[model samples]
Target: MTVDEVVSRSDLSISSAHEENLRAGPQASRLGVLRRSFQREVHLDAGHVLAERGEAIEKANLVIDGFLLHTLHDGPKRAIVGVSLPGDIVGLSAFGIGSMGHSVVTAGPASVRQLEFPLFEELSARMPSIVLQMASLEAAVQRQWIANCQRLTAPQHIAHLFCEWRHRLARSNGMKQVVRTPFSQTDLGDMCGISAIHANRAVANLRNAGLAEIRRGDLYTSDWTELEKCARFDPSYLRAVRT
Candidate 1:
């Protein structure tokens, strides 16, 4: 789908005017001006393919904001990885090896810092932080994959996801911060390894139970305690480590 469609379908609240300023400023990476010689930024729409199936690998993205999904297409089945929230890096392994595997697509309208693979490799030679962060992120992704492989039903998986989200947001200071969440039931369901109907039902159940409020392409937690119980989530997985 096009970026426009993602914008239309999502209830994301981004300032176009400020975004323009950031894009045009000397500090902005997209402009390639001062203070931004190494980093590049890209805005992706929901369902937009960051990299299509079997596409050449050129860059690995660090998610500065929004959500994304990694999917594998095996003839008739499409298996989706869970949501890649902010602070969660994507395409690490593929980029590390200098090749691409599967398709990395946007879960919704997302803002990302796109570091060229060559540049990343070059920087890693000098900056240890990049390598460390990539390693940590890769480990996280591996764990998620293992977890999904032995996962329960979709609803149960989603419950786990919700719990994880809470922990993630809390660790990132995102839970208490005021920012728009850009996820729909369809997208959430896709990440949870469940059907869209089931995903919607799960969200409705959360809302009716007064733990979260899911509406108009927005997902917000109203009662963290209740939400935690619904998902039976533990916060340990969301811990942040210095890289």
Candidate 2:
């Protein structure tokens, strides 16, 4: 499906995420100006490959809506290295790197503002805050990978991801303790380093233990404090502000 198809199927709130981004902060004005410079706004359907590993980095993308998977692909094997949420700039690391480090694939319907490499460099020099914010996002992605790979168990990884998504989506939606996920169990498995069957079991265990619950693609946790403990989660990794 195209972007129009996705919007038609959604809550008819296609511009909700875009509006939120364009009005977010004092920096939004400058960002908006920069965005207006770019002519292409891409709407990707699920399973679309936004970027491939080792491909020449020609442009970067700012996600206005939906999610994407950053995968490290080797032969036929692929492991999800990160997830690009709304407000994320996909392929930012490729700015000076010449080639993409990982493959970026759309997980659901998504819209992105594509910025050419020259324009991206210009923006970095002209708008330092934008650069800083992008750096912060890169740090967050690295931290998440560390947390998922080295710090947390499979179940803990699942809970921690849910918590992170809640915080991220809540930043824009203002809905606490509830996150509408477009990711399926297979996607969750890729993100959490497990099989789909294992991910299902982990979700079941969380539900059975009263730690988290999922209904109709929405995740909810009645007790965040307890869930945090269970997941060994730290919100600091999710912070976008410069330290």
Candidate 3:
């Protein structure tokens, strides 16, 4: 999708995630400047690598319409560390760094607005609030991922992942009972640190409990409150900062 297309989409409240932080008061006008500064829009198919681990960072990408999987590689083994959704920045760490610590690839067909490193640096210098907002978001995402892998049980882990995604989608787009996703059972397992078979069973448990179900490529939840309880989810960490 082009920048104009993304801004015009009624489903998206702003052109970029950072823009959301600057939406109110006088900072609102900076949104237009930020949008125009974006270099270009690039589209990728599923499994396409956006950045390789330890590779020099040339630009940062703002996710426009799909998911990006963040993974860590060690020899032959790999672990899914995080997933970047719509309105999320994929390579913000590149701002003051030369290389990405992990590999990032498209989980499905996705589009991103590329901000060249020099331009990103310039923007960051001019608008310190953007850096602050991005840093806050990055920290929250990391803390949530750590909790998901360490504290939650298999079923709870899976449920929490769904709940988090649902909350995030609601923020970027709009709230809905059914969340459209591109992640498969294997992908879900990777995110939750479980095998595909274990992930299947966990999903079954959620379905049996009338909490949630992953059918096809969508997550259907009947009872939001119950599902939140099942996942032990607290949405505060994922809440947008309104000023």
Candidate 4:
């Protein structure tokens, strides 16, 4: 289906939904198997939409390269809800519903390891290990929401988000604290419920405090502690895992 069609279409079949379990987290071996099950590969340029509203998800993606924005749409306007970076999984809602909750579009040039919808359903049912891996991913996404909620304003929300995102990257990469932040001021503004101008001001204030260095579209968090404090951002509030 086309991107424009998603908003108006709703006649998809129920079989599009797949079964899922909470155990999918903290399991490495099962996730590898699940990752390999995907045969189709999607290479998206920046601005390409991965899934649109009401579009039946015949496949979901694992980011092989680049970033994705999970966005909520209202008419021609859009709002970014969450992000998908490397090692992060996207398309979880595709398994629980007939269509996506929002649109998933490439924030940058990206490629995804894509899996067949029916095969994914079968794997989830047959491999108990798959459930564990899925659970792990689901938990991470949950924590993001909790983290954003603690912020008193958009600036704090952005600050908390960066710290949380950095921590997740560290956990996945053997304590390496550096990450190449991909979003722009405008992107952050949308996710944080603020205007682009406000996002830019927040970034400037953060930089003046020696907390981060945003050059071009890349943001470098030199002192995460300071940034967190300046944002009044707290991590204890954002632990997406149910456990």
- Best prediction by lDDT: 3
Question: Which of 1 and 3 is ahead in lDDT?
Answer: 3
Q: For candidate 1, what is the TM-score?
A: 0.68
Tens-place lDDT per residue, model 4, 1-243, is: 332232122112111221121134444434544555554577889889888878998876777778788888777666887777766656666766768878888887998977656656666665655554455656656566655655356666766667766665554454344556668888888888778999898878767767776666555776767777877755554344322
RMSD of 2: 6.8
lDDT values of the candidates? 0.58, 0.73, 0.76, 0.65
Off by over 4 Å in 2: 1-39, 215-217, 240-243
Which structure among the candidates has the greatest TM-score? Answer: 3
Alpha carbon lDDT of residue 87, candidate 4? 62
Candidate 2 C-alpha lDDT tens digits along 154-214: 7788888888777777655665767787888877887777888998888888899998886
C-alpha TM-score for every candidate: 0.68, 0.80, 0.86, 0.76
Evaluation by TM-score, superior candidate among 1 and 4: 4
